[model samples]
Target: MASGLFHLAVFAVDGGPWEGPVSWRKAVTFGLSFGLTLITIAWVSSFVALGDRARNVLLGVFAADCVLEVALITVQAWRRVPSHFNMETALDTTISRMLAVGGGVLIVVLVTLTVAAFRDGAPGAAPDVALSMRLAVRAGFVALCGALLSGAAMIARGVAEVQTGHQQAAYHVAGALKPAHAVTMHAILVLPALAWLLTFTRFSEARRVRVVAVVSAAYGAAAVVVIGVSAIRFATA
Candidate 1:
């Protein structure tokens, strides 16, 4: 997070449009996004019953991958080159492919954690808290999966355009899903935090669960609308 803030400060001082692939915005956004995501995953995973060694290994790899991805983006931004779908140079291509692979690793780790969340339940908590944690974590992970798929779509479309000799179009078209991608990615933190906050209230377990359900439904609906619009735009682009 501090690194992201520093990048933001630099961006402010340097003053550039935030729309391009090589913009400082990419570095700042990825840094903050992945950093917060790492923290959220670690927190949420604590409620799951993964053994200590397994948890450590999974999170270790996840954390390292996040850092690597962000570092690559930051490096490319500093080099004044696009970080994704840029095949102009061997180094750029390698970095772009590594980012894609990092995304796959993220999906695997989160899927494993999500499965554990469902399978083990939140041990050593009150029933209400347990239920809230379970629903929040599950729903969050599902939304996160949506985010990942949308990201993959963006990369695929961008790479395809690049391959077809439409380099500039690749950047424009690849961002078609950015709105949906951003909206869906943070559900893991928002939904779980909401559930946790409700636990401190006087609502019964059933009421809390009901509230979480309603919120999740609303979130899902919003995600669907964004995704539909983005999909249309992507297709047209």
Candidate 2:
């Protein structure tokens, strides 16, 4: 919430210069929103799968990663420069590398959380809710992996573009993958929200579970289709 407010404050100020359609202010807004969403889902899922100590440590790491990432991106935005694939100067190069490291940490933390979920079945949720939350976290992990891989590809291509003197091409390359990445990254939130809504329905436990199962299947299929479209777009471009 603080992060989002800060981003809004920054947005209100006149940014002297920005990159492309995504200004640094807008990027920070997106980053803060994504970070908050991640934190919320992690907190909720922790109750279902992780013990206290493990939950604290994981949440701490996740929170720190989010904070650091947003800080770096926000700083770059205020400096009126590109945050990613920027190697024009030593400072820019260092910041870019740090951002990459943050991305790696995000992938590691989420993957570990997902593994923990699988290691133990859902504990705090009702039978149907447990099924939905478990599936949601697992699907969220899969989606996060897709996001990370596509982002990695984007970073690599962006770097190549810079090396080849086509700096603007960096952001454009692998752009189609953003939709797939963004869509999947929120499954943790969306599916779990759906699960929570199910709890209020008049359906019996069995019916709720069946509905969640069908919803999960459909969500996964939709995610796959998005990824497929991204792949085709990337190939054609």
Candidate 3:
């Protein structure tokens, strides 16, 4: 999170419009988002029972990739060039491909974690807490998949535009799904945190589960609406 705040400070000093892929906004957003996401995944993973070596390896790679992604984006922002889908130079092409490949790595790690969330129950918690954690983690990972899908769409669309000689349009059109991407990305934190917080309340175990269920449904509904709107905008764009 400090990385994000530092970028926010940089953004203040740099003083530019907050739109565009190359803007300070990208640095700040990626820094904060990736930082928080790493933290959340680490926390949620504690509840699941994975082999130590495998878990450590996966998380280590995930952490490195998150840092690498944010660092590249920040570097490009400072260089004042488009960060993704830019092939004007050999360097830009390399960075763009690296980012794309990093994205694929993220998907694989998260998908593995998501499957584990469903396949194994939360260990060492009260039954209610376990149940809540289960629901929250599953829902959170699913929401995260939505974010990944939207991100993939953006990259695919942008790459197509870049390939067609419409370089500037590539940047603009690629962000058509930003709303959905942003909205769905953090459910992993929000839902699990919500479920965790409910544990301290007077609500009974079954009631807590019910509450998580209702909130999960509400979150799903919101995500659907956002995705639909983003899809429309993407189509029109």
Cα lDDT tens digits, model 2, 1-237, are 576677666766855334362475545565767666666656565535666676777778878878788887777776778888888899999988998898888778777776766665444433333665566656666666677777777777777888899877777775667778777777777766776788798887677767777877898899899989987887666
What is the alpha-carbon lDDT for the whole of candidate 3? 0.87
Regions of candidate 2 where Cα sits further than 4 Å from its true position:
12-22, 121-129
Off by over 4 Å in 1: 121-129
**Cα deviation of 150, candidate 2, in Å:** 2.0
Deviation of model 3 at 5, angstroms: 1.1
> What tens-digit string does per-residue lDDT give for candidate 1 at 124-187?
4223336876888889988988998888898888888989999999888978899999999999
Using TM-score, rank the candidates from best to worst: 3, 1, 2
lDDT of 1 at 91: 98
Give the clashing residue pairs of candidate 3, or none. none
Give the residue spans of candidate 3 off by over 4 A. 121-129
If scored against the real structure, what TM-score would every candidate get? Answer: 0.94, 0.85, 0.94
lDDT order of candidates, top first = 1, 3, 2
